[model samples]
Target: MSNHKDEVEFPKMSFLLMAVTTGFVGGILWSLIGYLCYYFNYSTIEPNILLEPFTVGTWRESWIGIILTIILYGIISIGVALVYYILLKKLNTMWVGIGYGFVLFLVVFLILNPIFPSMKPFLQNDINTLIAAACVYILYGLFIGYSISYEHNEIKYFKEKELKR
Candidate 1:
């Protein structure tokens, strides 16, 4: 049996496919939603503009940029999902997801903004843009965080039930 210092330990599944899949789905969904918000002028930041640091040669300004950006979002989210599964999977609370998303907002906007020349400081963006981005991030976090924790709890419940049998 596994042991957690603060929470009940769960049985290990043979694979962690749920986390990976949730990452891609959450990533693509948030990127598209954010882009739509930008398209409708509610947000000033282009969803793909976060990729400015790794893209080059006018590519970021091209149609391919959007596709690549979405793919990158999926890739990055996989790691982020894995992190949530590892660190916060046992928390059993949705607030953790909201807090996690807010943390991500801070990391991306305040900490990582300097890495992307096109990104403005957190205080510089208008309220709408900030709200739009925050909502998107929070939604993404809720998706990943809630799903993982729910699954972990479900598995733990089943395992305990089986043990009692």
Candidate 2:
């Protein structure tokens, strides 16, 4: 006989909220990594520039662009998190998260950049920029993956506590 307790039923609304929280947290990590790369001259690109391409020329010149970029970056991060939550929820581990990040790097730097005109410039960037971008994406993935798994565990823990009460 299986000795496992019944799986806890996670609430959909809370799950969604948790996903958003994780996404934003991941986005912040990504942004911090970008700044570090920029500081080291490894890359001059930033989330503000990528998320708000319309403001590319004046992105670093104003606060409005920075705000818009942060907001848009958060939304993009949330979208990525949603994809993980919906499609890859069953595969959650630190190493798996690292792999996920690498895969995301390939998708953006190799496939999408080559196919999409808007993304072509990203491809044309210097080698250091490319590397930096890959690292940043990987970091974001790591954060997202870890966050999802941790949040799920927390939910399970709470559910078990309730049952014991």
Candidate 3:
């Protein structure tokens, strides 16, 4: 007979919290990197330009624009993390994350290009800009995907190991 307490199920919050935190970190960090790359002339994509569609038509070079973009990315990433948790949490592989990042990059650069007036279409972007932005997205995806996957798998692994002992 199994212990009643052990058999009983409870709502888990840590994973959800981790997903939120990781998503926020990934968004904030990656967006900052992207913005910096743009600032340094390493990438053509920039946050203020991307967000111009949402804001009044004015070029904001102040710290406020940068902070707003970073925060907005973090918030968006929280939703993205939830999506990953719901759909892709079971796949504990690094490639999945990398692909996820690449997909996001494509979505923004190609599919979402028309939505933002400031964003150049995929064809208009040179190879270097694409590479730099793609790399940032890839790393962000890795940060979010691998983190959630590892946490999920690590929990299951330890449980299985304990059961076998």
Candidate 4:
């Protein structure tokens, strides 16, 4: 009986920890990817143009950009968690998580690009930025979806075990 209770509690705790860790790690990874893109000029017109518009003139702008990227990544991570929660509530599978991630990326991209017209010139008109954004978002979605799905599955498995007892 004690063993059963321990087993039941362990998974709940593990699931919660996994979810939090995954979100943090995914956020960091996404931010790192964004910084790399900016540094490599993947998102700029010229190889070093990411710093051109910012007046501090040095790579100090890159630091500011990194901070902003981290914030954006955190937002993306939270969005992924919410989407995963909704899908779990619906009794859907991991595939739904991925689908939601992709849909969210597209919807956000479309809505935001219009609001920030400056981004439109870089991403919409420029091929490099467009490709970089697409690739980064795809990787971000995949990682977040996979991590959440893994956590969700662990929770479901524990629930099933509890039911069997």
> Model 3: runs farther than 4 Å from truth?
1-13, 57-59, 162-165
Report the poorest 10 consecutive residues by lDDT, candidate 3. 52-61
Q: Which regions of candidate 4 deviate over 4 angstroms?
A: 1-21, 45-65, 88-97, 121-123
Cα-based lDDT at residue 40, candidate 2: 84
30-123: candidate 2 lDDT, tens digit per residue: 7767767877888756545554434446545477666666666777888889888877666658876777888988877676654443444654
TM-score of each: 0.87, 0.72, 0.86, 0.65
| Error at 143, model 4, angstroms | 1.4
Winner on lDDT between 3 and 4 is 3
Model 3, position 160, has a per-residue lDDT of: 100
Q: Can you write out model 3's per-residue Cα lDDT over 1-165, one digit (the tens) per residue?
A: 888678977776687898899999988988889888898988877776757777774445578877888898999999988888888998999999999988988988878888888677898888889889899989988888999999999888988999998
* Candidate of highest lDDT: 1
The lDDT, on a scale of 0 to 1, for candidate 1 is 0.87
lDDT of each: 0.87, 0.73, 0.85, 0.61
lDDT of 1 by residue, 88-160 (tens): 9999999999889989988999988898787778899999999988988998898889988999899889899
Error of 1 at 24 (Å): 1.8
Cα-lDDT of candidate 3: 0.85
Q: Could you tell me the TM-score of candidate 2?
A: 0.72
Candidate 4 root-mean-square deviation in Å = 5.2
Task: Sort every candidate by lDDT, greatest first.
Answer: 1, 3, 2, 4
lDDT for position 137 in model 4: 69
